[model samples]
Target chain A: MGRALSLAVIFFLVLLPLGVGGSTLFQLPVFSQELVQELLWQSWLQSAFVSFTFTVGLILAVCYLSLWLGQRITAGLSSSRIAPLLAVPHAALAVGLMVLLSPSGWLVRLVHSLFELFPSPPAHWWIADKSLVTMAVVLVIKEVPFLLLMIAAQRDQLPIQRWQTQAQSMGYSVRRCWWLVVVPALLPRLKFPLFAIAIYTLSVVDIALMVGPNTPPLIAPRVHEASLRFSDLASLEAWLGQWLMIVLGAMLFVVVAINQTVYRRFGLDAIGRPNGHSAQRICSGFGSQLLLWLCGLAVLALIVQSVAGTWFYPALWPQQWSLGRWINEWPYAWPLLQNSLWLAVVSAAIGVAGALLVLERQRSQRKKALAWLPLLLLLIPQLPIVLGWQRALGQDAGWLWLLWSHAAFTFPYAYLVLHGAYISFPSRWLYQAQSLGHSPFNAWLHVLLPQLRGSVALAFAVGVAVSIAQYLPTLWLAGVSYPTVTTETVSLAAGGDWRMASVYALLQALIPVVLLVWASRQGNQQRWKSKHVRN
Target chain B: MLEIKHLTISKQQHVFLSVESLQVAGGSVLTLMGPSGSGKSTLLKWLLGEPLPDFQIAGELWLNGKQRDQLPIHARKIGLLHQQGDLFPHLRVLDNLLFALPRKDPRRHQAALEALEAMQLSDKANAWPHQLSGGEQARVALMRALLAQPEALLLDEPFSSLDTALRGTVREWVFAQLKQRDISVMLVTHDKEDAPGTIISMKELTHA
Candidate 1:
């Protein structure tokens, strides 16, 4: 029975989407010459450039920041600081970045208030919306925390401190030791996360819509636009766009693979035989802190803008603060908030439960072959698979399809979060429980579950975060029938209502942050209470 | 008596350990000493009814005249103690003991407290597992195992984790408790001193 459930979960979560998407690829109509030319030369080229740049920037930043934090602070503290940034959805972060980096945004207001560089908002800002540079910046900022988190998770498996100590004892400098001994080991382990990051950057839709180039937007946004229209030509374009993303993803994988090989062959040797003078520092702890603070400031800008009254350009502070916008928006916002809450909660619950079933089956079989199966859902480009689901299921979007789509995305994250801890849990503990006269199921429920409460809670919280941040799935599967916080935020921001968008975006970001805090606190409290149990 | 007949353990078609027949009377210890990875712990796991997918084994187990080979781990009514004791970390010392007792018994709590008193751990009942010293944890683990009222007990290097100074005392106490309960015992350890009676080495049991 357990085996059957696990196989069913695998079929539904991993294989079914891939199968549908693959079949859709086979059935795609031939693309028109004009559409093909426009996509290849215009959108695809720009997307490739942006995605490559973003992936490289994200990799460099995450590596430098991870090494710096590993040297300066405990992993625990750094994760706590970076987690809120991760909790903020891509669209919300893009909207916040728009608030901060736009011509009339907070940064301009602050600079104008200080230097009087302009009498009013500047006409040309370096980080302008609807541009490639701004899109890349937002993608990098939004993705750095995720890559850092992936690296941090692998920190325990490597003997980093011992390696550093050994290298330093052999007379290598601290920085040299990190570059030589530590980074090589870490980069290999980070391969899957790098691929996931690369794929996400290549095909992200919501952030692109909010901040990407407008003249010929990136391929993902093009696909998204085409997918929304009902015309046959548009549907063919969308199908072809899906194939384009797959092609781009394959190219990125090959490039990353070649990069890995070349680095292993020559890059390590080049670094090992460095010139007498060490290189100047490329990253500092201060810079990483600044990035985090920038995210915080973006969130702060959202808060201030959401409640601001008659705040004009060149004014650092709002002319007035009022709760009137919130009060007025609440009536319209209440049901969306309720839908978002229940959808996130229910989807997260289903994701975690499904993950547990898969993990239990893996445990019973004593194999880890299925471990990477779930993560394939994460590594593959989500746009095409979700589009395929939309095509296969037709327009009969209901609560069931909405929840299923959300869980389809959330399940991978839940599995990723729980796989390591669950697999490595001591079997002897459960065996001992069984020997104490509890049946297998009872032993698991009474003994193993309690021991795994902290991890399970964390997985559940991450599932909630993933569900709340879902934009494309919620939009494509359910459309406006279920207006989630994510969909509403994106639409509002795109419609040029920063105040209403901020309100929705803030709620989208807050639910995940709140869930994360509550989960971690619950874990800590369980630990503390267990130690001080009363007589 | 706890008896085994025609016990042969193998992996991938090559026999590693075989015992033609063996028996231990109630209140007695049958010691099997072997180096690590010589099927000492494997035999104990098989006896406990754990599924060792990598190995093939044929054996008949009888406890107190009943053929117990087909029984599940819980139904086998056998207790196992390991090197680390493995007291459930989420439960307090007392709660760990109480967990082994039947849930519907009205006096189970009292029974757990008395067991703690017997091990001189009454004052440490409410403490977490990590808060207790190694010796105290071993005592609690033994008491928890015995509280389940098993017809037989298996010890897999249960005293190896304790310091040399604490080892003799804990070993003596464990033997005394098993004797008092008159439970049939099979103990596997590398140290010969852990055995109180006859010791069977792995070389004697292996046919291949």
Candidate 2:
């Protein structure tokens, strides 16, 4: 049964892009090469900054910074600390970022009141100013938590203690060893996650919508809008844009590949660097703290807006406060909560189970590509996938379709967590069990399963969080029929109703936070319960 | 009696461990000493019936006059104790022993308790693997292996991780326990002090 599921996952991972891409081609009319090539060139020129260069810079910077942070902190400590931020969806986070960074946003208003300082123009000026710096900052904020999570996963796979001791004994500082020894070892595992960040930062539509230079939005948002309009030329061009985004993602993958290839070919795979402490010790400490504090402020801003009766700019706090938004929204919110709950739970179970099957197969086989198949699935952005599914299913898709789409995405994310957990599991466990009188099946059931229950729970929780965070996929496939917290948050944010957006974003963020807490608790627990019983 | 006739193991077109003939009568241990990478662990893997796909093995394994060359590790009824004392961290001290007993065995709990009691560690029935001291873990692991009712046992550097002061005592206890049950034993260790009856040099029995 496990093998069959594993083979199906392998086939699915290998064939999904080709199948979907071909189906989309049949659904949409093909354009002449000259016209398609010209539009692609034009779009590339327009989007090259926000989509490619800035995204690349942001991903590299975030990864390096995260690597540095991972060294300064332990994996257990950092994972828990950043897990709350992990549940904040990209679109919702952008909304929160916009509330903090816009010209009339909280930062400026605080400055105006405190230092009697104000910009020459209105504070809302840079909200749509088309500055890469402005967007990259927000992207960095969102990407850091994810990068930290990936780093935590990779940290467990390394022999860091031996590396630390070896390097330190040779008169190198611990931080120096971290960069020279640890970073090189980590780069290979980090390649896929970095690509994920690159693709996401470059091609997120909903978040781009919240923080758009609407005059000429990023390629993803532009393509999304044009595709929705449904003209043949626009459809053709939108598909082209989606294809181009895939090509861009491929380029990032290629760069990482080429670097590793060159390094390994030259015997640089285990290369070490000269030892030195950077001048940024104080800066890194300050930056990490500031990042956390601001994220706290972002959540706080969401909280304030959820119950804010009315509000205007330059007032750091709300004009009035009430639970009216929550009360009024409760009627529709109840069903959404129910829908989100069931969808997340069902999808999580299927996804995590499928992921375990795939991970188990990967464990016995020595195929590097198969191991990375899940990462590739993750790095491929949801926009192209949703568009393909839109073409395949048309207007009559239902709950089953909804579950498939969400599970398809959720499985890979769950696989990432479960793979790390399973890999770190001591192999002696199963071997030792089998060497006992227990049969092979009994060994897995009686021993290994109990040991891995926490990881399974964590993977399930991650799947649930991934499912709840679905916006474009659910919206495209299920329409408003299955209104999840994420879809409702995006919808409310689109209407410029900050109050209600906050109500749902907070709720959206809350569900995953609760699930994550549950997951962590489940995963961290020892197999044996406490010996002491209540008297 | 346990017997091995012409057992050979290889990986990637290269032979690593080979034994022409070896035997251990009931209540005796044959200590096989070999350097690292000399397939000390691989020999145990073969006896336990889990030789890797990379390795090729051709042999006949006999336990108490039954020719059992091709059986799954669990069905072979051969107990193995590793250097790490690989107890189930999730199972308590007593339950670890209970896990080894067959489900249909009428005296499962009684047997588990007796095994714990025989080790003089009944006070640790609820103790976890991590909570036990190294010597306690080793003793518990030894008792757990014995309670499984194996006709033969394989010990792979089982005493290597113990403190030098405690190592000899644990080794003696393990040998005494095996003899009491008349369980044939193949103890692999580099320490010559661990040699009980016969010492088989794995280096002298190799073709690939």
Candidate 3:
């Protein structure tokens, strides 16, 4: 797995140039004619610089924002809230944001009615605009929640409580302890998630294409368009090469130039000190609750707008609210939902089972076994691996194979959730069971499983969420005719119809949202009660 | 009878346990005492063959005249307890005790109920481990270990999570239970005051 992922990273590093070069090499006469004859020193340098800057700026901005928001959320509530938020599928959220942010979206429609400008909804292209503003905003919103969850997972292990308690015992206040002690303690664990978000923002095609600037669409979209539009495998490969190069260069910047710069300047120790910005409490009391409510409202609006019938122009409320789309689209949507659910269930189950096998296999031996593979898999953008795998395996494949490939993505997430528990489990429990004459398998089944129930459930939920959120992989691998919620959501958003897009997006988000809420409540009850109650 | 011969254990690349030799006759209680960081707990882990990596165990461990060092933990018939009593948090106190019994037994539940009844924790048969007081939970932890019906037992700071008042009472109950079961026992603790019969104080280690 480690070797495979390392190869993946190397392949991704070279993707953009290889893709572009491949495209150039394989150009059909028509495209060759359209290709820039004067691909001069200046134009090449200029485009490269812009891509570099945008990727870098985007990476830094995403890392900073995720770190900041994750800190805020964890500080305000129990980090447990993060688990549910993390379970919200990223592509689904991005598609939802497309509908929410578009000029004629629910936001504008609401504003239009409030201003009594009633006859027709304003025709505007705020989202899927030439500006990447909406795309960046969408990225931040989707990623911060995920970063928060990752941070939450690490908080218990990293001496957070000790740091906070020590800070409080000193002259620092509780709020100060949070800023000085907690946030700094959080940043290191957060670095991985931050890096993942950065890589994602750099290489994301589905979301970027859905709401991103279209004229010279982000590099990812360019590769995607080339691959999908042309049967010319060479051209697709060239564009993938180009995409890989640019993303790799950006990843290096994030890891070396950008991250090192931040660490050298601010450092973990300095962060916990009295940074002037720490004094600013952005959300408080009713304001904080209102913020949560607003986020919830945005999600709700996306859900409502997706199902709204005759909800256009000047009306504060939709003239009709119907299950028309849900019904009309049932044939397409139901299978998609079923496909998404089972794929998630099976993949997560497999991933978790594999993780258990691998961990147990490595246990008798003392090697680390690249435990970061699951996390790294999560962080590294899906486009490169999925595309590479898709390219390697011709597009025509069975649905079961498609599901299995999706599990490749889903497995990492499930493994990540379960790995921590598996590692931390008290060895004495196993020993006692053994001494009592329980067989190894019996110990695992009877003693270990009950202890691991919470982790298993959480991992299953994570797997399901990852599988459900998958966009590019599902599209490229399953051929999109499968029409999973994610596949539908991305396609609808790709078409740039905010209402219908939002509808599909809501469907996409709904499945995970329902699953997450139930999982979180169960997790909370386990925390508040006994292990017995947890069972 | 259980014997530890030149047992050495380590954790996370640190040498924690290096006890040269020790022995407990069947039905005897051997309480080990040391300051914090003295590797007393490491001794327990070593006896159970779960020694941390820094350990370079080079001696024989004997159980009932058999060299049990090469045996797996389950085969050694040694039960263990910890500071929190380490009761199965997810199981009812009764079920937690019943867990030690073989599942194939038709009278397992009856035996479990009888065991809980013996410990005077029969009321907690349906109660969760967390619902019990520290003393009650500690009693149940010991009872759970006993239900396994091991020939020997080891404990690592089993009463540390309890308050002092409750600690002595629980300690007495554990010792009394061991005496009643005639199970050879070795206990490790940080506090000298908590040390049990035939107290063995860990000595400073030298390379010789």
All candidates' TM-scores? 0.90, 0.90, 0.86
Q: List the residue pairs that clash in candidate 1.
A: none
Q: Residue A191 deviation, candidate 2, in Å?
A: 1.0
Tens digit per residue, CA lDDT, model 3, B67-136: 8877878787888887756676767788887788888888989999998888887787998777888888
- CA lDDT of each prediction against the hidden true structure: 0.79, 0.74, 0.66
lDDT of 3 by residue, A1-535 (tens): 7578657855653353134344454545534433533331324344445545666667666555544554455422533455545555666666555556556556666666577563554555545443577776666556656655665556544666677678777867555676555655555545555666656666677777676776545666656766666655446443444555445645544563457446546755675576444334563333334434435666777777767888655566788988887778777677777887787778777877877776665554554323655555555555665666676556755577677777776676666555555665666677667766787887888777766666676767777787787777777767645658787777776776666666666666776677666666655655554433222
Ranked candidates (lDDT, high to low): 1, 2, 3
Of the pair 2 and 3, which is ahead by TM-score? Answer: 2
Question: In model 2, which regions exceed 4 Å deviation?
Answer: A1-38, A41-44, A118-134, A258-275, A278-282, A366-370, A526-535, B103-107, B206-208
Residue by residue across A125-150, what tens digits does model 1's lDDT show?
88886787788778777766666665
Order of models, best TM-score first: 2, 1, 3
Deviating ranges (above 4 Å) for candidate 3: A1-52, A71-80, A115-130, A231-237, A240-261, A267-279, A282-295, A358-370, A376-380, A419-421, A530-535, B6-21, B191-193, B204-208
Give the RMSD in angstroms, all C-alphas superposed, for model 1: 3.8
Which of 1 and 2 is the better model by TM-score? 2
Q: How close is candidate 3 to the true structure, as a TM-score?
A: 0.86
